[model samples]
Target: MVAFMRRRTAAALLSITGLLVLALSNPAGEWWTALQQPYQSEDLIKCAYDKCIPEGDDWFMAHLNQTIHPFLTPQSNLSAKDFLWWKKLQRDPNDLAAFKRVVDKVFQLFPEGKGFMDSGSQRCRSCSVVGNSGNLLASHNGALIDFSDCVFRMNGAPTKGYEEHVGKKTTFHIMYPESAVDLTDNRTHLMLVPFKTRDLQWLISAFTTGSIKFTYLPVKAKINANKDLVRILNPQFIKYVYEVWLRNSGGYPSTGFLGLMLAIHICDEVNVFGFGADQNGNWRHYWEELKDKTLRTGLHSGTEEYRLIQKLAAKGKINFFPGH
Candidate 1:
């Protein structure tokens, strides 16, 4: 009996020691840090080993060149003449052949739905990436923005309501489920940002509501009953965010960056509009009409990334607004 008592005391002491050790340590740190960190799409790609630049086009070009090269058909590899012509056209393909190349590469990647194919199914001409900016107001972009085969919007863009400011035609509503459902009205198209794993549940719930259908995307998947409504992006593409990008972008990739990376991967030529904050660092979307206009705290985390965006835009590698 004394022997048994001694063994019991030792075992109890060991169990308490183990519990104390576990209490002091955090096993979840590895995964928790990964989830909280900033990320980019290209960083998640196969060739995504390099870090991001806070300012410069050289890295942007390297990433774009690598990401787009694999998907570009031999026909669209831009000879000097086509390159010069593209410069003249501002990514607006006037010729049907050029248009088809863009469509085959870009639109083929977007999952098909009944309304997925627009009026000009085989061609994408004069695509206007309408930034959700108050600037479009009286700027007279109505004729310019309505011409694309597909239109994209971000973060509670009000198109039908502010037709002059935000533009009337919204073919794609690209944003996170929380942002899309929170900020947007019924008619605006919904492009989703699948950041968290479960946001897809909300995405399908929104789609089945039948007010406006959505095409939920690549970084995340919809595993629910209404998963049919989603158009998922490949996970190889999503790895670009974690493995290559978050480290470079300092924390997270912008929604615009994600869309741009996707466009670079899928489109022949890409044009970005109304990206980056204005001259002063303020977070405002196209749909917003701000009275203060002073920099406000918000989810659009563009403070550190603007210079990087500017450098790329100036290099003629990308099209970003508020030119230097």
Candidate 2:
């Protein structure tokens, strides 16, 4: 009887040790930082390397068509009917042939699947959508943000001096033709949120013949990003976010809002930070100093978007850390 008890105690000790090792190896960071807190979406991001999805665009478009159709439209069909929708989005495909040329050129520039496509026992895939809100200034969420499976940063939110608050890791950087900036590393994926066909034309030109430079806003003739790591947003997806999600409340959707929706589609669980306004009710970026008292979320309905974000969080679709 004594020998049996000794063996059972040893087994229990080993089990306890294994649990401790698992917890330390895959730390859940912000979601379960406290002992009593329940596990959240951010808790699922494992530390293993991300698996790249083969022929990613085909996979994404296939999924989008089935579920997020019309809203999540891709280049499944660049026909006249699709061009009409693009025209409605202010793309102005005045000539069908010219529009086809633009679409063909864009198709050539589109990159294959690069990250988080695998769905095996190893896939946990938690994502963090880091906005440029002033609330992140002193939040010191850098460690927490970096712990995510992927971090999506938008609109030139720098991390050099602000590493303590925003974290230095960026798995994906989302931008538009006008908002594009030179990336410091090849590891982060560069996702172009093209607003119009000219934006797609600009991307092809920047990487190929280098003819187009100025758009509605002047842009760089060339950008620094790995060609293989680049991805472009479907214009249909943008329109979908505008009409279906935002319910056509604003002239267009903000890049941050669109970025969040993209994360919702790709990530298993998403954690949002540095979004919305700051404590003083100033609608400004964390990097900015001057305050605009009359600042509004240009062309995007800021009030409704905030409300929607709140609703998503309440519904357990996301964990929103409104630091301010």
Candidate 3:
């Protein structure tokens, strides 16, 4: 009888040990710890727009998935299968060797590329995702956008003279080789969204060799930006945005949408600006005149994406400011 009791106790201890090991290894362990502790006002997780509820909170838990890491660090590993899947998005050639070479060079230049901006303290980190929609024209949301802790802008959206309509404060600029532009501000981080191996290669070449000037079309040979503040988005995160968030809509998520997701993951409170069409229902950028009023979102499912944005807004997940 004593031997039987001892064996049962040993099994119970082993189970507890396994549980402890899992909690330490997984990032969700923080949430588990939060669940155990008494609900204190200071201990509550504060997000950009709302304070997360203590128990049975579906909204906060659903958005915060620790498994899906959004950025690529030097230690990140990409399997051949995942690489092949990512390359197919842009129909890039099947050249894993070439891609690895570029990736290696990129990490060598930017060693500290992993992780994202997170407020470790009780302060709520707010983020503003500013798109290039024509609705931003005359919207006068410049001051409102600059109020956030971090501002994310995409592509060739210029803010030189349109400071009143679109804020001058650009914390992070998201772009690819095709939409590349010179970032005059040293404080801004150049976040490159690589769609192909050549895109990664171009990032290296732009800063160092200036050898690559074309990718399906003419690209900038050299870009004037701070290399130390450079960041590359994880391909796995792109897949997550496409499969989970977008539900495999369009060719892929637009840069603006990607910026919005990035903000959702990082910021406690998120404010979206300069999305959708102008009052005239024309899809054009705020900086340019309406040359193609009939033009629609190509490659990306703009209509569906906007619909999802509206749903998220209705759910109070994000504050969506539809520009006039």
Overall lDDT per candidate, in order of appearance:
0.43, 0.69, 0.77
Ranking the candidates on lDDT from highest down gives 3, 2, 1
lDDT for each residue of candidate 2 in 1-324, tens digit (9 for 90 to 100) = 224224433643664465456568766643223321223555443423343222234423433332442221224445565456666655554566776577666666665443454445455566789999899988977766765668999968898888778977888899887888878877778888766678778888887887888886688898888887777766667767776778788887888888888887776557899888899888888887845578778878888888878867765566798988
lDDT of 3 by residue, 18-81 (tens): 5467677778645334322222345323432233112134754565555767787766677777
Error at 257, model 1, angstroms:
2.9
Error of 1 at 274 (Å): 2.1
The candidate 2 region of ten consecutive residues with least summed lDDT is 65-74
Evaluation by lDDT, superior candidate among 1 and 2: 2
On lDDT, the candidate that comes out on top is 3
lDDT of 1 by residue, 127-217 (tens): 3455554445555444234433345666556656555334456545566654543332344444555443234344544534433233343
Candidates 2 and 3, the one with greater lDDT: 3
Measured on C-alpha atoms, candidate 1 has an lDDT of 0.43
Q: Where in model 3 is the C-alpha error above 4 Å? A: 1-64, 119-121
Could you say which candidate leads in TM-score?
Answer: 3
